[model samples]
Target: MPLYKTLTPNSQTTVKIWKITETYDDLLEPISLKPENMKRVLGMKSELHQRGFLSVRHLLLEFGYTDDDLFYDEYGKPHLKDGKHISITHSFTFSGVVVSDGIVGIDIEKQREKIGVIAHKFMDYEYQYLDQSDDKYINKLIVIWCIKESLYKLFATPGLSFLQNTLVIPFTLEEASTHAWIDYQDKKYRFDTTFFEFEGFTCAYALPS
Candidate 1:
């Protein structure tokens, strides 16, 4: 499951996911990293985080990109040398990337009951339809969190608060898609969002509408 999945959201965008089933040495063996990234990875204190970082490089290769083609801004959002938009995320054993000609974002998050304990920290508007008593409560919360994170990565604007600035329109798992908005600085930006569950995690992505 090194390359767990791939998505072509549109002709101009691509998404790749990797399941970190490889050891650090196994993943590093095939990668060519610039000195800075090599040091960053070497300084990681957790093997899980280290493997997650390397797995993303593998995801980049799946998209026909090399580590050299990617760079980050002061806000920590990723950019491509070719000018395509790119977003990266990894949680536990899974890592994902989305690259596009236009603004785009993607995220992967493991569903956990703890998310419910802090849902209020990042939720608004969504409360109108959410019911913690439902069996799918935690699942829905994870979806919203991942969706907001995707939008946040796309926005990458400082002072944008997830609880106050982003909203995921009402949706059910079966629908597989929904409308999301980022209301920041008095500007309301809409996005076409999609999500799916794999194993125990949720992955969501957003593109400007």
Candidate 2:
């Protein structure tokens, strides 16, 4: 199954989402896995993660690239062989990839009640403006979680607490997009955020300035 969604935030950036339903083998049948990657593949916990890898591989191919077209840095940040910025994400049943010449980050999370329990740990400024009018609080929390996680990925810095370092400017739950910032040291990184509901999941992608 190929679940597809495209986001065009500006003339300079575009994002594509692919939801994969096939088992790991089914998705990897078309691609060649390296010995190192194959070794890592043997450690995957579920078919979900397996397919996630395959789906991202397919994504690279779609972008006119191949497996060898990507490389990971010491921090595990992915960079295109041609020097484009890229980010990858995967959840229980869905996986996503976003690539751009600019800084980019992508995240997918299953909408769940449990995320609410840890909201305070990552939600500081966000708590001030979260609309409480809706009874679906979990949905609201999931949206915030996705946004913060996307920020975390974008920052790629260790020891930055979500609640302490990241802040979301308030918005209605029904809104299609939100804005957020990361204050790390003296530099403030701002992001234009967008979230959408799909297959019991909330997916968020952020581009940095």
Candidate 3:
């Protein structure tokens, strides 16, 4: 029953986020799933993942979509039959869906100190301005990770390197928005990414800049 927050970044895009506060059964009971999706969710070993999967269906319902309207390409990027662009992301306690008239991506992640431990793997250019001593360092890192993840979802191409091919422009938490680029396969792309934090989690969405 928790529909959570909804967003309209522009006239053509909508973002919905669900805060999971229901038992697996409660989430499962309300929505009808495609047979394959039912089998897929039931087979998930982690209850967290099971709930995450179900919550996305609820988000889809908010957008007036059902599993039948969704499909995955060979690259595993999700698509809507009506030709609108879409991307989805789920974390430990939240799930997000972004539907747009143009290309878009969305992600939600729990903000934690551990992100700094793995920052090296996905971050490169931003390191020049990233200082560990800053109080907002963790928050900034989470935003960068989410931004890169959103771009990855939008690009949907294999061999896209977060470290080598993607870069997040410098910004403070107060700004809440930045620009990023994807340099892959000898082509370059740009996106405008925005992020916000809630209940200890960070969620970001990307749209073509």
Give the distance in Å from residue 7's predicted Cα in candidate 1 to where it truly belongs. 1.3
How many clashing residue pairs, candidate 3?
A: 0
Model 1's lDDT to the true fold? 0.93
Q: Candidate 2: give the clashing pairs.
A: none
TM-score of 2: 0.92
Give the runs in model 1 whose Cα sits over 4 Å from its true position: none
Model-by-model lDDT, in order? 0.93, 0.80, 0.93
lDDT of 3 by residue, 1-209 (tens): 58789889999999999998889999999899999999999899999999999999888888998888999999999999999999999999899999999999888999999999999999989999899899999999999999999999998888889999999999889988999999887888989999999999999999999
Per-residue accuracy of model 1 over 142-188 as CA lDDT, tens digit each:
99999999999999999999999999999999998999999998799
State which candidate has the highest TM-score. Answer: 1
lDDT score of model 3?
0.93
The CA lDDT at 27 in model 3 is 94
Task: Find the 10 residues in a row with the least total lDDT in model 1.
Answer: 1-10
Candidate order, lDDT descending: 1, 3, 2
Model 2 segments beyond 4 Å from truth? 131-133
| Reference-based TM-score of each model | 0.98, 0.92, 0.97
